[model samples]
Target: MSDQKTGGFIATAITSIAHFLTEARKQPALSEEAGYGASPNLPKPKPTLIPIMKIAPAVGWPEGKKPTPAKGFAVEAFASKLDHPRWVYELPNGDILVAESNGPARPPANWSFRWWAQDFVMARAGAGRPSADRITLLRDADGDGIAEIKLPFLENLHSPFGMALVGDQLYVANADALVRFPYVDGTTRIDAAPVKVCDLPSGRNHHWTKSLVANKDGSKLYVGVGSNSNVAEYGMEEEVNRAAILEIDRVTGVSRLFAGGLRNPVGVDWNPVSGELWTTVNERDEIGDDLVPDYMTSVKDGAFYGWPYCYFGQIVDERVRPPRPDLVAKSIKPDYALGSHTASLGLCFADDGRLHERFRGGVFIGQHGSWNRNPPSGYRVIFIPFTDGKPSGPPEEVLGDFRSTEGKALGRPVGVIIDKKGGLLVVDDVGDIVWRMRAV
Candidate 1:
C-alpha cells in the first residue's frame, strides 16, 4: 500500500484502540496537591505503549455567554469576533494589542500515525486554523471595561505570539524571527517596515510559539525557544540552540543562550519583586499522566534543566542513548509545579493592587488544558500568590467553566496579560473572545 493508505489504516487502528484503552491507565494516584511548590517530588514513571486520549472537543460559546470567574470577580467580553487571538499585549497608553495568528504550516517531512493523531487533537482543541498574520488594537476609550473601538494595528506578518515595546520601538516575535517597527505615541496603526532583530528556530517547529520578554532597562531581549522533539527522538543534531532561552542585546541583535534543557518554555516574565526571569515549561509526554509535572522556575543564566536526558533535576529518563551523566548532574530543579500535562503557557506577574486583595500580589497562569491525561486537567486560569518574590501558596482557580459539563470546550485560555487599568485579560482562542476579569 501507498503512504496515504498506510497512514489512514494506522489512524483508524489507533482511534479504535483508544476507546478501549482510555480506561486502562490509572487515575492520578496522588492529589494534584503533591505537585506544586519549590520541591516537587518526581513520581515513578509509568511508561505507556499508547497515550491516553481524552480531549474536550472545542465548541464555540453561545451568544451572551462567557467564562465563570472566581468569587468577588466578574468577567465580561472585552472584545469579540476575533480571528484566533492567541496573545495579548497592553500598551503604555492602555491600548490592547491582540495577536491574531496561529501555527504556520511547514514542509511535510516526518508524516506518521502519531503525527496525524497529534494533528487531530489540535483540530479538536481549536488550534488548526490558518494564520491571520495581524495584530489588532482594542480601545475602551471611556474606561468602561469594554473595547468600543477596534482597529488593525499591524498586518502582513508571520505567525506572531509575543509583543514588546521599548521607547519608540515595538518588537514583535514571529515564529521564525524577531522584528520591530517604529511606534509613535497615541498612534493606532503602524505602517513602517519592521527591521529584523534576529532569526529564530523554524521548520518542524514542534514548539512554534516563541514567548518574548525584555529586561527592566530594555537592554536585552529574552526569547523562549522550545525543543524540536519531545525528547530528541529526531536525533540530538536537530536541537542545536533549540530548547533554550536566547538573550539578545537590544542594540546589536547579538544572541546567546541564557538557559537550556527546557522541553517547551511557553511563558516568559520577570518577577517584579526579585527582578529575576521566570518561565512556564511544558514537560515531555507518553510517560504516563502524572510522571513529569509541568513547572515554573526562575531561569538562571548558563543553567540546564534537563530535557531529553533527565527531568526535574537529575531524574534519569533512561530513554536517551549515550547519556551524559555530567549534564544531568547539573540540571536545576524547578521552583513550582503546575501539574502534569496542564499545558501551562501564559505567565504574568501582578503588582497592582486595584483588584481584590486576594489577587493583588500573585502570578496569573493560563493553563490551556491537556489531552494526554485520562481524567483531563487544567481547563482554567489559576493564580499563584507571591510574597517577598516567591510563591507563597498553592494555586487557586481564577477562572473556570471553560469546558462544559458535557466535556465540550467553550474556550481554552492561552496568553494572559494585565490591562493598564489593572484588570486581567485572558485570550480564549476557541471562543474567539478576549475576556476582561475584574473585581465586581
Candidate 2:
C-alpha cells in the first residue's frame, strides 16, 4: 500500500507540474503595480480553472547574510536561532514577547489537484514546520537594542498568534480560542493558568491566524478571524463569524462582530493620528493575479468590504453563486490597495516610534511575499506616508533583498513592531531571527 501511494503521488506531481508550466505560459507576467492605490488598473477578470502556484523555495540565510537596509539605515540581528516565530508584542516594562508558532496539522484528505498542491507547495515555502506552541520573552536589560536575555514565558499554547495586555491580564488569541493569563510588570516568566475569554473559528481552519488588538482603556478587544476557505468555496454555512473582526468585552468576555467581508484580516492597529481602527487584509486568490488587490482600510462600524461576492468597489466576482445583489451594493471600498497577490500581513502605525524621519507619521507593513504571481511581489518591509490620517503617496521600500534573483527566499518577514528605544523590530519566520533596524 505504501509503495502504491508513493507511486501515485509522484505521478500526480509530474502531471501537475506540466499543467502549471502550460498555464504559466498562457498568463502574461504583468507588473504588480497595476493593482495599487485608490483607483487600481484592474484588467478584465481572468478566472482560471486551476490557480497558478509560484513560491520562492525557502533557503535559510547564509552566514553574515542579512536583508539590505534602506539608505541611512542599518539592520542587526536582535535575536537569532529561534523556532518559527510569527508574532511579536511589547510589554509595559519593555519586555518583548514573540509567538514562536506554526500551523497545526490537519487530517489527510482525499486526493485532489488543489489539495495536493497546497500540501506540497506550501511546504516548499518554509511553511511545513511543526508548531512551537509557546511564547518566548526577550529583555534588553542593559538598554541596548539586542536582547541579551531570552526565555520561554508562556508554554503549551495551541498555536497562539496575536496578543495584547489589558491592565493586569494578558490576552492571547489562540487558533481555537482567546485566553488570558495574569501578568505583572517586570516579570520574566508566567506559570499561571490561562482563563478562557471566548472561542474563535477553527474547524479545518484554512486561514487560522487570529490577530488581535485592544482599544483605549482596555474595555474591548478586536480579533481578526480569517475565512475557512477562499471565496467561501467551502460553503457560507461553515463561515459563521469568520472573515470578520470580533469585538469582545474584556471584563465580561462577550463578543460581537465589529466588521465583516474581510477575507483574511491579519494585522489590526489603531491609527494614532485618526484614532480609527485599521487592518491589513489578504484578499482571495485563483482569479487573475491582477484582480482583487489586498488592501489596508479603516474599520467602520457595521461596514462591509466585499469578499467572495465582489471586490474593489462592486467589481463583482462571478465565482460565487446565488448572487446577493443587496450585499454587493453595501460593500464598502477599501482606502488603499497594496498590490495584488502581495500577501500583505503586518500593519504598525508610526506612533511614538522614531526609527527615522522618513518613517515618521506613516504606517509600516510587512508583506509576506506572494506564491501565485510570477516575479512574486512583497518580501520586504514598506512604509506608506500618511498626511492627516490618510495615505498620501505610494509605498517606500524600507527593507528589501528578502528574495534573490534565482527565486530563493533568505527570509520571510512577518509581524513588525517598534521597541521602546524607537528602533524598528522585524520578525523573520523563514530565517528564524528577530532583526532590529536603526537609523545610521
How many Å off is the CA of 44 in candidate 1?
A: 1.3
lDDT of each structure? 0.87, 0.87
Q: What are the per-model numbers of colliding residue pairs?
A: 0, 0
lDDT of 2 at 289: 68
My TM-score estimates for the predictions, one after another, are 0.96, 0.96
Candidate 1, position 406, lDDT: 91
Q: What is the C-alpha RMSD of each candidate to the true structure, in Å?
A: 1.8, 1.9
Candidate 1 lDDT over residue span 93-153, tens digit each: 8899999998888668756556667777788788888999999999999999999999999
What tens digits encode model 2's per-residue C-alpha lDDT throughout 1-440?
Answer: 69669857865775487456646576576785667777787878877766667778899799989999888899999998899889999998888999998877775663455555666667878888899999999988998789999999999999999999999999999999999999889888899988999888888778888999999989999999999877887789989999999999988889998999999999899998999999999998877767678999999988899887899879898889867899999999999999888889989998864776666668989988998776588999989999899999998888889988788989998899888788888999999999998887
In candidate 2, stretches whose alpha carbon ends up further than 4 angstroms from where it belongs are 1-28, 108-113
Candidate 2 residue 418 C-alpha distance from true site, Å: 1.2
